[model samples]
Target: MGLAKVSSFLLVILFLINGGSSTTFTIVNQCNYTVWPGLLSGAGTAPLPTTGFQLSSSESRLISIPAAWSGRIWGRTLCNQNETTGRFTCVTGDCASSQIECSGAGAIPPATLAEFTLNGAENLDFYDVSLVDGYNLPMTIVPNGGANGVGKCNTAGCAADLNGVCPEQLKVTVEAAGTTGVACKSACEAFGTPEFCCSGAFGTPDTCKPSEYAVFFKNACPTAYSYAYDDGTSTFTCSGADYVITFCPSVSSI
Candidate 1:
């Protein structure tokens, strides 16, 4: 082969050996009701194959994620379509896209989020299920088939249903069937205060401390992020792992 062609071949081999392979995300919906899952790639990251889609109970879908991709996934509940205007919307975790696909829009607050930073520093994939935005439904991230990395590849999520026990001040209710709590709001989302939001005077971790509301979530799901600075126990790391993200995972399995 020509020298240029040989060099090109060598580069291709190097790319495949060093983070060129894609990762698979298997999204499962175990809720009794339907769920509309939304995905948003981080700024400057490549877009995913599909931004949003519907998943009936017991249904699942597989998505291929390029190496080094970073993004979040969340499920929308109580979604409906407006026949007159052909608009789509959800009671919780709506992306405001007016369609099933979120396009590039992120979830509205009060949504449970499974955030991922794949192939990051030290080639570890950092992941966490966050209620820092608030809680909508039970969700978990289970890493599979990863080589031992910096941190344990343990499951991370808020598998407990927080809506029913949510504080009245943080409850989001819908009156469709009757008055029902569908989601719980973070103190920041509920009150917009500097302390709850960890902003302004409370921007630093030293100044911002978990409040009563955050403590409620922490007590319920010790491994999930309960507030802006609840990082010590919330984050998990793995390398070259395919993820299984399940919404409304069974308590016994969690």
Candidate 2:
């Protein structure tokens, strides 16, 4: 109503439009080999400058994400680019685009996912390291600064080498090099049964108990999604903090 009040109201409106504060994601490639990190914004969310970029062993990249943004990130491995088409293809976590820039396409399943919904109600950010899709590379999401004021904002991920113990049924292998497994598949992908996928008769949490396969993943990564109904403990929330996403972080780090 008053001129000063009107000015304050306009500022508040501008803040929402511009996103009150930005969060930086420092993606680190700690793997022994090179990896191309892929990023995809959720539907209707603002896109980042580069969808995919190369990261050699021990290299890192810092990306500033706008407030209220939501998206998923993953690492692409064993990649090769076609000089003519300028398209990139990877052994794991390759999106449909088959290029350096994923555009709006998400990674093909059986790839580890670092999912985030930042700056929501009460200035909290909800994030998780999910193997629900499956595990290609080990990943950890660490919150920095005063993000731990609340309870349980701990690091999350599957830091172990799951592929070594991946059951034969759940092993995904590249065609050209079919001897060794490249990624571990979720029970849902390995077998589309209702019980494994939590679909049809097993759609509800009460109906679908964790299977032995899911349990294997759960044991390896207690903080990550082992199956479709892993929300209870898999999802984590933090406030006013940036993030460090590392591929192949030490097991003790989480």
Highest TM-score: which candidate?
Answer: 1
Model 2 residue 133 CA deviation in Å: 0.8
Residues 1-254 of candidate 2 have per-residue lDDT tens digits of 99999999999999876777688999999999998999999887888888989999999999999778999999998899989987789888999687778888899988999999987667678899999888998999998874557535778787988877888989888778666888998889888889998999999999998999999999989999898899988998888788999999998897
TM-score of 1: 0.95
In angstroms, how far off is 34's CA in candidate 1?
Answer: 0.5
Give the clash count for each candidate: 0, 0
List candidate 1 stretches off by more than 4 Å: 1-12
Error of 2 at 42 (Å): 1.0
TM-score of 2: 0.91
Measured on C-alpha atoms, candidate 1 has an lDDT of 0.94
Please list all clashing residue pairs in model 2, or write none if there are none. none
